[model samples]
Target: MIEERGRVLSVEAGAVWVETVRTSTCGSCAAKAGCGQALLSRVGSGAKRGFIRALTDRQWQIGDEVFIGIPEDAVVRGALWVYMVPLLGLFASALLAQAAGVAEPGMIGAALLGLAAGFAVVRWHGQRAQRDPQMMPQVLRSAGQVMPFAPEGRLNG
Candidate 1:
C-alpha cells in the first residue's frame, strides 16, 4: 500500500474530500534542480485534492487529518496505462507505416493517429475503471489513529 497524508476539506456521507500536496520523493536529490520531474512539478504549481470513502464505519469530523492509500497494483496499472500503452502504439504504428512504404512525413501522421487511438482507448478504459471500487483510493487512517502528522505550513512549504 502506498500512503499519503491529507487534510480533510469536507465530509459528505462517508466520503471526505482531502487536500494533499504533491511532494517529490526526489526533491532533495542532488540532480533534482536540473530534472524534468522537478521542472514539471514546479510548473503544476499547486496541490491536488480528491475525495475518498471512509474505510471504517466511524463518523469523521471536518478538518480531520487522514492518510489515504491506494494499492500498489493500482498505481502500477495506472502508470502503465498512462505511459506505456500510448508509447507502444505510437512506435508500433510508425514502424508499421515505415514497413508499408509510407513516406517519412506521412509516418509522423500515422504515429499521431496511433497516439490518438491509444488516448481514445485510455479514455474509454478510464471511464470503465471509474465504476470499479477496487480501482479507487481509500481512506487508510483517521486523525484519532496513533499517527503523528505535521502542520499545514510544513506540508505547503
Candidate 2:
C-alpha cells in the first residue's frame, strides 16, 4: 500500500476532500542529494497542492488529519495508462501509416493522430474508473500513524 498524509478540507457523505503537499520518499531521505526523486523535488518546486476525495467510514471534521492509501496494483496500472499507452499508440500508428505507403508528413500526422486516439481511450477509461472503488484511494489511518505534516522548509523551496 502506498500512503500519504493529508488534511481534511471538507467532509461530506461517505467521503472527505483532502489537501496534501506532493512529496516523494526521496525528498526526505538523508541521501536525497543523490536521489532522482530529490532532483525532481528540487525541479518540481512548483508542484501544486493536490486534492483528492477519499472514501472514509470514520467521521472527520474540517482540518482533521488523515492518511490516504492506494494499492500498488492501482498505482502501476495508472502509471501504465498514463505513459505506456501513448507510446504504443505512436509506434503502432507510425507502422500502420508506413504500411499504407503514406508520405513522411502523412506518417507524422498519422502518428500524432494515433497519440490522440490513445489519450481519448485513456480519458474514457478514467471516466469508467471513477465508479470503480478498487481504483480509488481510501482513508487509511489517523494522522497519529503517519506524520501529521511534512517538513516545513521542504514545501516552500
Candidate 3:
C-alpha cells in the first residue's frame, strides 16, 4: 500500500474529502537538477495543497488528521494503461499504412488518428474504473494513532 497523511476537509456519504500537502522526492532523485519536473518544483515554494475524496466507512470530523492509502498494483496498472495504449496505437496504425502502400503523408495522418483513438480508449477506461472500489483510495487510519512499526530510517520520537 502507498500512503499519505491528510486532514479531513469534509465528510459525505461513505467518503471524506481530504486536503494534503503535495510532496516530491526530487531532493534525493539522481536526475534532480537535470529534469524539467525538478526545475518546476524548484520554481515553486515546494509544498502545494491538493484535495481528494477518499472512500471510508468510518465517520470523520473536519479537523481530523488521517492516513489514506491505495494499493500499489492499482498505480502500476494505471501507469501502464495510460502510456502503452497510445504508443501501441501509433505503431500499429503506422505499420498497417506502410503494408497497404499508403503515401508518407497518409501514413503520418493514420498514425495521428490512431493516437487520438488510443486517447479515446484511455478516457473510456478511466470513466469505467472510477466506479471500481479497488481502484479508489481509502482512509487507512487516524494519523494520531501509534504505528505498529516506525517507518524505515526514522526512529519513534
Candidate 4:
C-alpha cells in the first residue's frame, strides 16, 4: 500500500476529494545552477494541489487530514498488461511468418504490424478500464488523522 497525507476539500456521495502537495527532487541536482527544472523550482517552489477520492463509507471532515492506500493487486495487474502484450505479439508474428516461408523483408513487415497491433490493443484496453467503476482503485482513510502527502507548508492552509 502507498500512503500519503492530504486535506479533505469536498465530499459527495461515496467519494471525498482531497488535495495533496507536490514535491520534486531537483534541489540536490549537480546541475541546479544551469538546469531549467531548478530555475522553475526557484521561481515557484514547486508546490501544487492534487485531488483524490475516498469511498463514501469512509468518514472525512472538512479540513481533516487523512491517509490513503493504493491496493497491491491493482499495481500488479496494470504492469502485466502494459509491458507484456506488445512483446508477445511481435514475437508471435515474426515466428509465424518465418515458419510460413515468408521472405525476410515480408517477415519484418509482419513483425512491425504485430507490434503496432499490440500497442493499439493495450491502449484501447486501458481507456476502457479507466471508464469502468469496478477497475477504479479502492481508497481507505487513515484513523481520523490527516497525513500530508507532501510535506506541510506547501498548502495555503
Candidate 5:
C-alpha cells in the first residue's frame, strides 16, 4: 500500500474533502539552475490546491489528519499497459506493414488502428480494474497522538 497524509477540510456522510500538499520534483533535476521547470516552480512555490474524494463507509471530521492508502498493485498494473501497450502496438503495426510491402497510406491506417485498439484496451481494463478490490483507496486515522499533516513530509512536532 502507498500512503499519504492529508488534512480533512470537510467531511460528509460518505466523503471527505482534503487538501494535500504538492511537492515538485524540479528541485532534484541536475539542471535545476537552468531548467524552465525550476524557474516555474520558483514562481509558483506557495500555491496550494484542495482535493475531494468519497470515503468508503468511514467517518472523519474536519481537522482530522488521515492516512490515505492506495494499493501498490493497482498503480503498477495501470502504469504498465497505459504506457507500454500503445507504444508497442504502434511500432509493431508499422514494422509488420512495411515488411509486407504495404503502402504508406495503408501502414498509416494500420498504425492508427493499433493505437486506437491500445486506447480501447486501456479504457476497458480501467473499468474492470476499478471493480477489483485492490484498486480502491482507504482512509485511516494516523497513529496515536494525532499531528498536523504536512504536505512535504511527516508531521513535525
Candidate 6:
C-alpha cells in the first residue's frame, strides 16, 4: 500500500475530503543540480497543495490528520492505461493507413485522429472507474491514533 498524510477538510457520506501538500525530495537527491525535474519543481513551488476525496467508513471531524492508502497495483494499472492506450492507438492507425497506401499527410492525420480517439477512450474509462472501489484511495486511520502492539503469534488482548 502507498500512503500519504493529509488533513481532513470535510466529511461526506462514506468519504472525506482531505488536503495534502506535495513535498519534493529534490533537495535531498544527489542529482538536484543536474535534473530537469528539480528545475521544474522549483518553478512550481507555489501550487503544491491538492485536495482528495478519500473513502472511509469512520466519521472524521474537520481538521483531523489522517493517513490514506491505495494499492500499488492500482497505481501501476492506472499509469499503464493512461499512457499505453493512446500510444497503441496512434501506431496501429498509422500502420493501417500506410498499408492502405495513404499519402504521408493522410497518415499523419490518421495518427492524430487515432490519438484523439484513444484520449476519448481514456476519459470514458476514468468516468467509469470513478465508481469503482478498487480505484479509489481509502483512509487508513487517524494519524494521531496509536496501534496496539501484539506479541508474536498472539492477538492483542
CA lDDT, every model vs. true structure: 0.74, 0.84, 0.87, 0.73, 0.73, 0.87
Model 5: residue 71 alpha-carbon error in angstroms: 2.8
Tens-digit per-residue lDDT, 59-86, candidate 1? 6665677888889999899889988878
Off by over 4 Å in 6: 145-157
TM-score of each: 0.73, 0.77, 0.86, 0.64, 0.71, 0.89
Model 4 gets an lDDT of 0.73
Model 2 bad stretches (over 4 Å) = 24-48, 145-157
Candidate 2 per-residue C-alpha lDDT over 1-157 given as tens digits, one digit per residue, 9 for 90 to 100: 9898888777899999988777567745799887777787668869657889999899987767789999999999999998988888888999999999999999999999999989998898889988999899899988863223333423222
Model 6 C-alpha lDDT per residue in residues 7-34, reported as the tens digit of each score? 7777999999987778989999999999
Off by over 4 Å in 4: 22-49, 131-134, 143-154
Ranking by TM-score: 6, 3, 2, 1, 5, 4
For residue 77, what is the lDDT in candidate 5? 79
Q: Tell how far residue 51 is off in model 3, in angstroms.
A: 0.2
Model 3 lDDT per residue over 31-103, tens place: 8878999999889874587788999999988767899999999999999989999989999999999999999
Worst 10-residue stretch by lDDT in candidate 3? 146-155
Candidate 4 lDDT over residue span 1-157, tens digit each: 6656677777777778777676667877788888988788778844566777755476566667776556677777778888889888899999999999999999999899889988999999999978765556444555465544334534443
Candidate with the larger TM-score of 2 and 4: 2
Clash pairs (backbone) in predicted model 3: none
Candidate 4, residue 125: how far the Cα is off, in Å: 2.9
Superposition error at 18 for model 1 (Å): 1.1
Q: For residue 44, what is the lDDT in candidate 2?
A: 80
- In terms of lDDT, model 1 sits at 0.74
